[model samples]
Structures are given as C-alpha cells and as structure tokens.
Target: MGQSSSTMSSPVIIPAAARHTATLIFLHGLGDTGHGWASAMAAIRPPYVKVICPTAESMSVTLNAGFVMPSWFDLISLDPNGPEDRAGIEKATNFVHGLIEEELKNGIEASRIAVGGFSQGGGLAIHAALQYPKSLAGIIGLSCWLPLHKDFPKEAKGNLTTRLFQAHGSADPVVPFHWGAETSALLKQFMENSEFKTYPGLSHSSGEQEMEDVKKFLQEVLPDN
Candidate 1:
C-alpha cells in the first residue's frame, strides 16, 4: 500500500510465511515512513507472525520549527518535564487502538497481536498498549521513552501482565538513555513482566544483539499455535 491524500499512508504488509497465528503492528519514527522499519521487522518476525508497519500522518512538528513531517504526534521538546501534546498523543493512541480493533475483527485475538515501534512511534506504542481495553500479546519498544509518563500506572488499564521487551542504546542522544531507564522503572512499579535491555556504546538506533533479543521475545510471546 502507499500514501493517500485523505488518510494515513498505507502500511507495508509482510504476510506470514506459515499459518498466520499472530500479528505485529509496528510503527515508524518521526519523519520516517512505514517502509523504514518494514524490512527489518519482516526479517526478524517469526514465520507465523504477520508484520504491519504503518506510516504516520504528515503534520507540522513543533520541535522542528513547525516543519511538516510524518509523526505520530507533535514533539514540543525533548525535556522530560516539559509540556506534552496531550490531545495529539491521545488521538494517535486512538488510531493505534483502531488498528488493533481491525485485527480483532479479522479474527486475530487481542492476545495474538503485539504493538511495537522505534523512537517516537515506540513511545506512542507504549502509551497505546497500556490504555487499550484488552490485553495484548506483547509490547516492543527500541530506543524509545514513554509519552505522558506522569499519568502512568494509574491510567494504565490493560496489558499490565503482558510481556514487554524494551531496548535502549546507552549512548542514545535523541531519546536519552536515562529516559528509557526511567520508563523501565516506572513500568516495573505496576507491571512485573517487563524487561529493559541496554546496548553498550550504541547510539540512537538498534543493534544486531537487540534485534536478536527482540526476535527471541516475539517467539516467546507469540509462539506458533
């Protein structure tokens, strides 16, 4: 699928190589289209897992001097304590929920679907999975922090027990390494089934080891049925 004028760009769909027992809905980072992560995700996903990489709608990002780009929501600043775009985050999270609902309607159980992404998309994925009405199979976030972190554990209603694999580069400059650690700590306060992995010397991107860990996590959480 491709971009559209009235809606979000169509996702890059990688069909399951075997019987489709699970689905992974992955989102791309700011300024990036779904294609950015499609191939990598396709390569790492299990044979029974279908991967869907969705492109975010293009909009003017506040932090980029209002430059129009593909973003899940407007990033006001990198400051963890700074103001957040609550409305925009909620809207994007709702869109994620809609995607999950679509998968559910297509006969995939909520427990057979996972939501994941990188950077900004990963933050949105974390927020969306926590607030979803039904528990998901898993959650994966790489080099990302959680959006609206202050309201969590209380606002988090679903997927508390679902397995989560969060990886961060220790030297990440965009989404600081500290942010990922702090997010992990916050998640552990309420969710016991979460793992936070740190890649040494890495910066702002995924590594071979990290993807291997993610692949293992996916295989464990969405095993063949």
Candidate 2:
C-alpha cells in the first residue's frame, strides 16, 4: 500500500509481497483511475510481482459527448476503425513505455515484466506492447480490441516473442467480442505464443473465471524462482 508519483498523474502501486523480482504495469480503462483496479494485486496473488496501475490523464471523449473524464486517450468514435485518435494513443503509448523503462532501470528485465488492461486500456496495452522495442513476459487484454490493427504487420517484429492472453465476453457490447477475436487472429500470425479465451455469457467486465485464468497466465509467464 505504498504510492509514488512518477508523473503529474501517477499510478497506484502494490509492492510485491516477497521479493520484487517482476513488475506488472496495468492500465485503467476510460474514466477510471488506477485505484479502480488496485485490487488486482490480491486477486492475482503473485507474491514476486509488483503491480503498477497508472491513472490516465483526464480528457474529453468524443464518444461521451466531449465531456472530460479520466481517459488514456480520446475516442473519436467507437466504430472500431477511423476516426481514430492516433495522436492521443501515441502519447499514452509513450507514457506507458516510460513506466516500462522505469522498471527496467530498477533491474527488472523486459522479459520479466507484464503489461495488461481492460477496455480502452487493454487496447492501448496491445498497441503499445507491439510497438515496444523489447520482449515482454506477457500482455493481457480483457474485453478490448487492437487499435490500428492493420498497421500491426509493419510493427509486429518489435515484440514477436511477447506472449498474449486476451479474453472477451461473448456478450460484450461496448467493445464487441467479434472485434477481440479479430485482433487475436491477427496477433497469432506473428505472435506464436498468444492465446485468446472466450467467456460465453459475460459482459463488458470480468469475473472469477477470468481472474483465475489471469492468475495462471502470470504464474506461467512470470514464474517464481
């Protein structure tokens, strides 16, 4: 339960219970703060991993009628295609990338660090992880799709060895399940270690089954000594 301000808008961090051998930097969805998902530390129960949940800067969202809220980037539309917010996404990508570098400076290798998120944050996780220059332990996305997926081919080589665990509720409406599948399909072409799971009757959020899967994924990718 310690806090540090790496940026004007910093994240809520839960230090590892045992030795801090790994870092899990997770992003929050639109309109949510880092504290919103801070409980993930307990849910995952990875004693060797430190959890970092960064808060997104407040900004007006086009999908929400331009009302300002905490968002990783602006959503020009929910069309799953253009009118994309390229500039905003790039800024957030760099912001998250900065967090990765901080962990690296603290002695955590890129292969021992994981990045994940829900919804908008999940999409950014996929976008940023693909563009990151080093291989990561894993990438998790819950009920989110890849933003700018068509451009992934040119960028796939950045983290080809990074594993992915993406799950979507079949009934997800905000970010349709089909879109998530499409992203998983494309990722499998270059990211051979990726896996996508489906929750038959869930919605836009997660539940016990999904959390269990995440725990297993972390244990597999960020194993203890």
Winning model by lDDT: 1
Could you tell me the lDDT of residue 146 within candidate 2? 86
Model 2: lDDT to the true structure: 0.87
Task: Please provide the root mean square deviation of candidate 2 (C-alpha atoms, Å).
Answer: 3.8
User: TM-score for all predictions?
Assistant: 0.96, 0.94
Q: Clashes per prediction? A: 0, 0
Where's the lowest-lDDT run of ten residues in candidate 1? 1-10
Can you tell me which runs of candidate 2 are displaced by over 4 Å? 1-8
Candidate 2: Cα lDDT at 46: 87
Error of 1 at 105 (Å): 0.9
lDDT values for all models: 0.91, 0.87
Q: What TM-score does prediction 1 earn?
A: 0.96
Mind sharing the TM-score for model 2? 0.94
For candidate 2, the 10 contiguous residues with the lowest summed lDDT are 1-10
Candidate 1 residues lying further than 4 Å off, grouped into runs, are 1-5
